[model samples]
Target: MNNQTISAQLLSPFNMGDLPLKNRVVVAPVTRSTVGEKRLRFMAKYYAQRASAGLIITEAAVISHQAIGWLNSPGIYTEEQAEDWKQVVNAVHSHKTPIFLQLWHCGRASHSSFQQNGQLPVAPSAIKVNGDYIHTPLGKQAYETPKALETEEIAAIVQDFSQAAQLAKIAGFDGVEIHGANGYLIDEFLQSKTNHRTDKYGGSIENRYRFLGEIITAMTKVLSPNRIGVRLSPNGSYNDMGSSDFRETFLYVAQQLNQYGLAYLHVMDGLAFSFHELGNPITLAEFRQVFTGPIMGNCGYTQETAEAAIEKGDADLISFGRLFISNPDLVERFANGWPLNPLVDRKLWYRLGEEGYIDFPAYASSS
Candidate 1:
């Protein structure tokens, strides 16, 4: 299936199973923890502004009370939150765009202040991943050694994700992407450095991958495999996540996910902020080899590099992170070769205000 080497092919249509995409540009989930009707209202407008993107993966939304680690971050475990997210989904769909809600659990990257009754944060093991701080209502706090999830508690976490998938459907989202990336709950379970358990949820590579596998299985009871996706950062050092078996674990995980026939596998392939810098890097091609479906390459992707990736068959889609924040019309700018709005202030990124949140101006039109 040879396609044309068109200049702005990123603007072309793509069909991810039953979901048809207008372009290959995806809005990677960024942390925006401004919670409330006021903030949700602005967020609706924010996502609507970027409707030209083929897909918009929302900021990580907590699955349950136990999953809240970020300050004022959104949640999907309640009816109120689901009702609130509908506004954002409806706004984006008004422009005929598809959006996927990203479900997350921060695991050991959290503080007890974010947990119920100040209970210790749950993780695969009782080990602490240093150099990570979680913002609490009080203030920023360092990560503490987490409580190893009891065998029974692991099932509860998987149930939380499954229930979140059902709520996302009620919230009018096109689909849901399991936040298996970074050093979140699922990531901690996947890497050996964090997962030292001897149960069915850890130990061997297959056992470490079971936590996510169980989630995908349970989530499928509500959403089909075609409507579900998973994001993975096999080479990440973020939240202090890495392992001795980085290459072997991710490859096997990718191979097994193929059996589920999911929509796509979103992989963090760039070296910037990656733990693979000190070791041999694993390429996206490795995942593509076994997972014979759509692959979305993320991190540090520019228009030129993204186009090259698409041309060379390295990726079926490219998710833009910081670029999408400053340029609401990123797909349009890339399609027409328009100048992009440079990101001005990094501090405003996580702040709870409209200063840099929704104030990024679109390109000045040349009449």
Candidate 2:
């Protein structure tokens, strides 16, 4: 496609709520999965490099100590962590780019090695993730059956989300996105495949949604609904997800989320992450039916497909993950018809330091 045609769809400016985006391209959150003292250092420069995106969602940041699962992933619980994040926000903001922090919890996707006193991870039920192993501080370990959260204990986790939102605001993030997808804590509660709670947090669809509902409600106290976003993966099979009632579950979720007037509803509609194949995958057009607010289509979208989806009114924005890693100047390349850099090696992805993380030169510099 010609540059004009490409710019018309993907590069077009958009007003996401009251925020003005220079373009519709977004930088999706990607976990580098690094550990140690170097974890938070280079992030500022890394994000600033890709500030051209309409919106930038940082890699998932665990909300609290209990939420810890990824070996060396960033966290939002401590004031120190929030303080460190301020540098990243300032760096991105210096380029006039809006960035959002993705709040996350690993839940049953975690191993006891990452937990306090070797305590087991917490989930809605005492079920183990059917996956073989997970990377923990001690090393790769077998997935353990998580301890079922007590009904009363649920409130603390909800508050942790709220507190994380508060810290995101303090860190100068434009907003926050709740990581409710990919079979994590909230996903465990949302899908029946993992959640078998008899309490208010499980069983019926509404009950299953209660955990996320409470989280959203709590977070809104710290930030307006318009400043928050939630992500869902109805078609995802990651972390042993995918339910037979996926359609009913997500449709009900969209319908309910429509009430909150959120910043946007991010749906991972593409099959890059692999689908559950419970039936035909639920498309962005399906979500558009229930949600009247702005919607972003994520996972495995290319310039052509993202453009087509926008033209068809199926999505307002598209978030690119792997592509953004190698092409720091992705928007510029797309605007000028420059070819994207080849995908980086997978082993280089999660390692600490500059190699694959921030060393990818922009198109101009590379030329």
How many steric overlaps are in each model, in order? 0, 0
Clash-forming residue pairs, model 1: none
lDDT (C-alpha, whole model) for all candidates: 0.87, 0.92
Top candidate on TM-score is: 2
Please name the candidate that would achieve the greatest lDDT relative to the true structure.
Answer: 2
Model 2 agreement with the true structure over 154-187: per-residue lDDT tens digits = 9999999999999999999999999999999999
Across 188-307, the per-residue lDDT of candidate 1 in tens digits comes to 999898999999988999999999999999999999899999999988889887787899999999998998889899999886656645468778877778888899999888888787
Stretches of candidate 1 off by over 4 Å are 1-6, 37-41, 276-278, 365-367
Cα shift from native, residue 358, model 2 (Å): 0.2
Q: Candidate 2: where is the Cα deviation over 4 Å?
A: none
